[model samples]
Every structure is written in C-alpha cells, then in structure tokens.
Target chain A: MYSTTYHRPATVDEAVALFAKGSDAKYLAGGHTLLPVMKQRLAAPSDVIDIARIPTLIGIEASSETLTIKAATTYFDILSSADVKRTIPAIAHLTSVLGDPAVRYRGTIGGSVATNDPTADYPAAVLALNATVKTNRREIPADAFFQGLFTTALENDEIITAIAFPIPEKAGYAKMRNPASRFALTAVFVAKLKSGEIRVTATGASQDGVMRVPVIEQALAANWSAAALEGITISEEGLMADIHGTSDYRANLIKVMAQRAVAAAG
Target chain B: MANVQLTVNGKAVSADVEDRTLLVQLLRDHLGLTGTHVGCDTSQCGACIVHIDGRAVKSCTTLVGQVDGANITTIEGISKGDELHPMQAAFRDNHGLQCGYCTPGMIMSAIDIVNRYGADLDEDTVRHELEGNICRCTGYHNIVKSVLDAASRMKLSIAAE
Candidate 1:
C-alpha cells in the first residue's frame, strides 16, 4: 500500500475541512473497499479522511413510512437493528447474507453504494425500493444515483450522509453468489409498494450496473405470483458476460431469480 | 507516520507506524504476534481474523490507524498461560487440523460464531457461518465437530460460572 496521510476527525465539519485541504482525498468509511484497492496499488490518494469514527454518520432510524440509514453504518448494524427488521425485513435479510461475518463487521452500506460495484447486494435493494441517496450537497433518487459499473453521481467532495428507503408493503431478495468471493453472480430484489406499484431490480447480471426489469415489474404488478413471470424472457442485450456465466445465462438467471424473489416475498 | 495506541492481549501497546500499515503487519512485525497468518492478502482468506472492539474483522485489510484506542484480541489472547481455550482443546481432541496453517483464524472465527449462535448451533449453521474461514485439511468434518464440541463445552463452562 502507498503511504497516505490519515485524518481521524470526530465531526463532519472537521472531516470536510480536512478533505478540502487535500489535493486528492477519499473518505475512509469502513475501508473494506478502499483499503483493498490501496493494497493492490490500484489507488493512491494523498489523504484519507476517516469518516467511520464520526458520530453523526453511524446509525439507523426508522419512521412509520421510511427507514433512514446513515451511510457509515456497517452491515452488522443493519442486521442487528430491530427497527430495520420491523420496517424493511428484506434489507435486514440482505444485510445478513452480505459477505461473511468478518466482512459484515467492517463493510459499510455507504461505501458499498458509493463504490457502486455491480455485484454488491445493497444497490439492488436500494434501487428496487426507490431509496433516496442523501449527500452533503443534494439528494439523488435511486433511479438517478447509480450510473454504471463502479460509477455513481457523487462528486469528489460530496459525502453521502444517509439513505432514506420508503418502506414497501412487501419485498424479497435472492442471489446466486460466487462460490469463492461471495459476490452476486446474478441477484434480484422484488418490492411491492403501498401504492400498488411493483419494482424489480437485478444486479451482477447487468452491464450497466443495477437495473430495473420493467417486464418483470409489469407482470408482477398485474399478478403478484411467481408464475406471472413464466415465459417472460429477459433480453440478453446489455447483460454482463463472464467466465461465471454468459449473457444468455444471466438473462435466464434474471428470470429465475425474479421468480424466486417473488416466491420468497410471498 | 501515525502514532497508534491500543490494548493487545490485555496489555496496552503503542506504536508509530506508517499510515498504510495494516493491523496484521503491526501485530506480526512490531509486536511479534506471529500466530496470526496472512493467507490471501486480498482479504478473502480469514487467516488474519481478529477481534477489534469485540467483533471479528480481517486485520490484514484494516489500517493500524483505524484501530487506534481499540481493544484487539489475536489468537495468542484466546487462551490463558498454560490452559488452552476450550476451542483450542476441542480442536486438539477432535483432530481438527492437519497442516495447521489456517488453525488460528479458524479458532478465532469459531469462538465468534459460538458467541453469536451459542451452544445450540446446528451443523448447517456452522458450515454457513464458517464460509469466511477456509480449511483445506480435514475436509471441514473434524473442524465442524470441533466447533460444535467447543460450543457445548463453552456453554457448560458458562453455566458452571
């Protein structure tokens, strides 16, 4: 790893001031992604502002209709949160299945969403549930937050504060994880909102990162059943193809995973 | 350089390390706690698993600066001076290891699993939770038995306390 200046600030204002002074700086939230990348020398930032210790960036709050999770909150926090489980059980389940026990202890939802890894589990949940990404500058809807693989609408200095997810009537997540890395090979999240609208999002299979499956959403909106997705083939276009699976195979997985997610929701 | 102070194995230790120095490096190199191995440095292998503030985390991926003022427990701290921890005793009794390369990480992770799930753990839960620790030897049969036996023994010890 490259030698970098480390700043541990107790408050957001201090962290922002430290960041503003650096030529190239990155917020160190949990450091699961950033540290690994730094280890490989893939990134060499001049400064690393440790936002993990900031008190304001670490918690989960649930209202009657929405779940607000601070960006720096770890997966372990979400898994153990009674409010999260009561308000959005699917997110709790997703957090439980993310990575392993060690990773869950340190990996933060904000870092995962900021990095926007296509195989990450949180993006599928965020996008399908129509969560709002709140940053220091502005709020970006889930639909507009994730741009593509390893990309987001976040500016260099804009730090994500929290994400607000509207509690759905019901939701479920299913993933076929890579045996070694535990990243999703193909995963889907199905959510049915109180407004009688359904949203389906697939991760790991999309070339453009987490994306909605309008066809599956349409089918489920019409009839909320696993059988409603039968014979509904996802187009192979713009789907990821790799050693693990072909584009056609991912398309097939999208259909199967959506069905399984619907069944799990039921 | 960054000055970090933390408690290790019930003793307070301080070090001046580079910002990029991993916790594993600080423990293994500076403190001479070589029991923690570094297999697959990319954080996939659980060889460097240690408890920071009572939670299992990969020390290899954690910057030493991040753990400032935190209490850390490595494999060396699991047992008392002469008596082995129950998990260690169970591994010995059940022949849970062959080469013993991954034993430290496996033991650390097992203690954490039992801490969370308690003695009533099933085989499937053990297998699922042990996903982070990889054991090439014993095909995980003896390792699984070891964890279960350790869990039961630990629970009995807790009850006796």
Candidate 2:
C-alpha cells in the first residue's frame, strides 16, 4: 500500500468534511476490499476516512415494518443479531455463508454494497428484499443502487449511512460457491413479501451485476413453487463468463439455484 | 504517519506508523510479534488471522490505523506462561500440523470457533468454520480433530473454573 493520510472521524459530518478536503479520498469501512486493492497498487487514494469508528454507522435496528442496518455493521454482527434472526433469518443465513469467519468479522455491509462486486452476496439480498440504501445525500432503492460490475450509483464523497430492508413474509438464499474464493459462482435470493409480491434476484452470474430474473419472478408470483419454473430458461446473453463457470453454465445455475432457494424458503 | 495506541496480548503499546501500514506489518516488524504469518496476503489465506477486540480478523488486510485503540490477541498470547492453550495442546495431541507454517493461524481460528460454538461443536461445523484457515499439510482431518478436542478441553476447563 502506498503512503496515505488516515483520518478517524467521530461523526458522519466530520467524516464527510474530512473526505471533502482531500482530492482523492475514500471512505474506509472494513478495508477488506479497499486495503487489498491498495496493496495490489490498483488504487492510490490520497486520504482514507475511517468510518468504522463513527458511532452512528455501526448498528442494526429492527422496526415493526423494516430492518435497518448501519453501513458499517459487519457480517458477524448480523449473524449474531437476535433481531435479524427473528425477523429476517434469510439475511442472517446469507451473512453466515458470505466469505468466511474472519472475513465476516471485519467485512462491512456498507463496503460490500458500495463496492458492488459482481459475485458479492449482499447485493442479491438487497435487491430481492427491496432494501433502501440511505446515503448522506439521498436514498437509493436497491434496484437503482447497483449500476454494473463493481459499480454503484454512489457519487464522489457520498457516504452510505444505512440500508432499510422490508421484512419479507418468507425468503431464502441459495449459492453455489467457488471452492477457492468462496464467492458465489451463482447465487439466487427469493423473497415473498407480505403484499404477496414475489421477487427473485440473482448475483455472481450477471455481467451487469445483481439483477432481477423477471421470468422466475413472474412464475413464482403465480405459483410460488419450484416446479413453476420448470420450463422457463434463462438466456445467457447477459450472464458473466469466467474461469469458474461459463455463461451457459451460469444460465443453468440461475434456474437451479432459484429452485433451491424456493425450496429452502418453504 | 498515524499515532496508534493499542493493547496487544494484555500489554498496551503505542507507535507512530505510516497510514498504509498493515496490522500484520505492525505486529511482525514493529512489535516483534512474528507469530502472525502472512501467507497469501490477499485475504484468501488466513495465515495472518488474529483477534482484534476479541474477534478474529485477517491482520494482513486490516490497516494499523483502523485498529488504533482496539485490543489485539495473537498466537503468542494464547499460552499461559509455559502452559499451552488447550487448542495448542490439542493440535499437538492430534498431530494437527506438519510444516507448522499455518499452525499459528489454525490455532487462533480454532480458539475462536470454540469460543463461539463451545464444546458441543460438531465435526461438520468445525470443518465449515475452518474455511478461512487453509492447511495443506494435514488435509484437515487432524485439524478438525484437534479443534474438537480443544473445544472439549476448553469446555471442561471452563466448567472447572
């Protein structure tokens, strides 16, 4: 990692002020992604604002209608949160399988959502659950937040404060993980909202980042059964192709994982 | 440079380090705590796993400035004087390691597993949780046994206390 200035701001306002001062400043949450990128000399920000210490950005709050998670909240915290387990166990389960024990300890939800890695676990949950990403400036719906692979709608110096997830009636996440990195080769998150809306989102398999599978969503909305997706086939047009799996393979995984996710949710 | 003051293995230490200095670099190069090894350094290998504020984290990926006021515990801190931690003893008894390069990280992660799951941990659970720490030597059979043994021993010790 190159030489840089680190600022630990006590509050969100201070953090924003510190960030605005530097020409090239990045908000440091868990540093799982940012630090590794820096060490590889892929990025060289002049200043790093450590938002992990900001008290306002470090908790999980559950209300009657929604679950609000601070941006800096770690995966371990989510896994251990009684509120999360009680209200949205699918999210807790997703957090459990994300990365590993150590990575979950330090990797933050904010960093994961902000980075929007194509294979990341949280984006699928965010999209399927219809969560709202609250930033310092404005709130972006999950549908609008993710722009593309490793990209988000976040602007320069914009900081994510928290994400509000509507508690679905039932939800489940099924992932086929890469043996080495543990990143999802193909993962699907299915949610049946209290309003009887069924949303299906797939991650890691999409070239455009986490995306909604309209066909599966439409089928599940009608029947809410794995067999409902029997004849529906996912086109390989926009799926990611890499060493782990081909676009054709991922297209098949989308259907398979969706079935598994539905079964798990039931 | 950033002024970082942290408690390591019950000892409070302060240092001025570059903002980009990794926690593993601070421990190994500055504080002379070489127990934390850097294997992959890409956060894939858990060789640099250590406890910061009672949580296991990859030290290689964490910046020194990020843990300024936190409490850290490395492999060296697990033993009590001359006595090995139950996890360490279990590794020896079960022959959990061979080359010993990944031993420190394995032990650290094992202790954490036991701390979270307690004595009733199952073999499958131990295997699943050991994903962060990779052991090329033992093929994980002995390592899994070692963690189970350590969890049982640790539980018994806790009961006695």
Candidate 3:
C-alpha cells in the first residue's frame, strides 16, 4: 500500500475537515474494502481519516415505525441485535450470511453501503426495505443512493451517518452465495409494506447493480405467493454472466430466488 | 509514521509504524511475535486471524492505525507456560493439521467460534463458522472434529470451574 497520513478524528466535523485538507482522502471505516484495494494498488489515498470510532456513528435505534442503524455498526452487532432480529429478522438474517465470522466482526454497514459493490448484500436489503441513507449533509433515499456498481450518491467528503429502515409488514431474503467469496451470486429481497405495496430487488445478478424487479413485484401484487411466479421469467439481457453462472441462468435464478424470498416472508 | 499502542497478549506494547502497516506486520515483525502468520494478504485465507478486543478479526487486512488502543491476542497467547489451550490440545489430539501452516489461525478462529456458539455447536454450524479460515490440508474433517472436541472440553472445564 502506498504511504498515507492517518487521522483519528473524534467527530464527524473533524473528519470532514481532515478530508477537505488532504488530497485524494478516504474515510476509513472497517477497512475491509479500502485496505485490500490499497494493497493491490487499486486505490492510493493521500490521507485516511478513521471514522470507525466516531461516537455518533456506532449504534442501532428502533422506533415504532423505523429501525435506524448507525453507519459504523458492525455486521456482528447487527446480527446479534435483539431489536433487529425482532423487528426485521430478514435484515438480521442477511447480516448473518454476509462474509465470514472474522470479517463480520470488523466490517461496518456504512462501509458496505458506501462501497455499493454490486455483489454486496446490503444494497438488496436497503432497496427492498426502502431505507434512507443519512449522511452528514443530507438524507439520500435508497432509490437515489446506489447509482451503479462501486458508485453511490455520496460525495467524496460526505460521510454516511446512519441508515433508517422502515419497518415493513413482512420481509424476507434469499441468496445463492458464490461459495468462495460468499458474496451473493444471485440474491433477492422481498418486502410487503403495511399498505400492501410489494417491493422486490435483486443483487449480484444485474449488470447495472441492484435493480427492482417489476415483473416479479407485479406478479406478487396480483397474488402474494410463490405460485404466482410459476411461469414468470426475467430477461437474460443486462444480467451478469461470468464463470460463476450464465446470464440465462441468473435470470432463471432470480425468479426462483424471488419465489423463495416470498415464501420466506410468508 | 503512526504511534500505535496496543495491549497484546496481556502486555502493553507500543510501536512506531507506517500508516499503511498491517496489524500482522506489527505482531510478526515489530514485536517479534511470529505465531501469527500471513498466508494470504488479501484476507481470503484465515492465516492472519487474531482476537482484537475478544473478537476474531483478520490481522492482515487490519491497519495498525485502525486498532491503535485495542487489546489484541495472538496464537502465542492462548496457552499457559507449557500446557496448551483446550482448543490447541483438541487440534493435536484430533490431528487437525497438516503442514501446520494454517494451525495458528485455525485455532484462533476455533476458539472464537466456541466463544460465540458456545458448547452446544453442531457440525454444520462449525463448518459454516469456519468459512473465513481455509485449510488446504486435512480436508477440514479433523479440524471440524477438533473444534467439536474442544467445545466439549471447554464445556467440561467450565463445568469444573
């Protein structure tokens, strides 16, 4: 890794100031993604501002209508959270399947959401749950948060503070892991709100990153059951096809995963 | 350079390392504690697993600056003077290792698995929890057996206490 200046700031304002002073600065959260990329010479930031210890960014708050998770909260904490498990067990279950035990202890929710890796698990949850990304400056809706793979609505200096997930009537997640990296090969999250609106999102299978599946959502809206998706199929176009699986296979898998997710939600 | 102060293996140690220095480098190089190995720098293989603040983490991917004042425990710290930790003894008795390159990490990770899942762990749970630590040898059968055996031993020792 290239040599860089490290700053451990106490507050978000201090962290923002440090970022403004340095050229090509990066906020260091869990360092799971940043450190590995830096080691491979993919990212060389002149300054790394450690925001993992910021007191304001480490917690989980559940209200009557929403469950707000601080950005710096680790996956382990999320999985172990009684409130998260009780309120949205699907989110907790999603956290359990993310990475391994060692990685879960260190990796943070903010880091994962900000990195916005297409194969990441959080995006599917965020999009399906209609969560809001609260940053130091503004709140970005989930629909506007993830723009593309490794791309988000966050500015360079903007640090995510927390993500507020609205409590849904019912929700569930199902994914096919890559086996090696354990990242979602083709994952789907199904959520039904109190008002009877259904939201379906799939990650790791789309070429454009996490995307809402209208056809499956429409099918589920008509009849909320796995049987509703009997003959439904997602087009192979714009889906990821690599050594892991072909585009057609992913398209077929999406329907199957959506059905499973719906069944889980039930 | 970054000034890192850590409580490692129950001893307070301070080091002046670069901002990019990994925790494994600090343990293996600066402190001369070579038990923590770095089999894969990319964080794939769990050769660099260590307990930071009672939780198992990949020391290779962790920057020294990130865990400045944290308490750390390496493979060298798990035992008494001569007696082995129950998990380590279980590995030996079960012949859980071959080539021994991944032993330190596997043991560290195994202890953590017991810590979280407790004495009532199943085979599938053990195999799932061992996802981060990769052992090319032993096919992980003995390693799984070792972890199960250690869990039982740990339970027995806890009961004795």
Q: For every model in order, what is the number of clashing pairs?
A: 0, 0, 0
Task: For each candidate, report its DockQ versus the true two-chain complex.
Answer: 0.85, 0.87, 0.89
Q: What TM-score do all the candidates reach, one by one? A: 0.98, 0.98, 0.98
Specify the poorest-scoring 10-residue window by lDDT in model 2 chain A. A48-57
Flag regions of model 2 displaced more than 4 Å. none
* Tens digits of lDDT, candidate 2, A1-266: 78889988899999889988998999999888899999999999999999986888999999989999999998889999999999999999899899999999888999899999999999999999999999999999998999998889999889999999999999999999987788999999999999888899999998888999999999998899889988998999989888888999999999999999999899
In candidate 1, position B13 carries an lDDT of 99
Candidate 3, residues A1-266, lDDT tens digits: the string is 89999899999999999999998999999999999999999999999999998999999999889999999999999999999998999999899889999999989999999998999999999999989999999999999999987999999899999999999999999999987788999999999987788999999999989999999989989999999999997999999999999999999999999989998888
Q: Which stretches of candidate 1 lie over 4 Å from their true place?
A: none
Q: What is the per-residue lDDT of model 1 for residues A110-153, given as tens digits with 9 covering 90 to 100? A: 99999999999999999999999999889999999999999999
Question: lDDT for each of the candidates?
Answer: 0.92, 0.92, 0.93
Error of 3 at A49 (Å): 0.9
Candidate 2 clash figure, as a count: 0
TM-score, candidate 1, chain B alone = 0.98
- Report model 3's TM-score to 2 decimal places: 0.98
lDDT of 3: 0.93
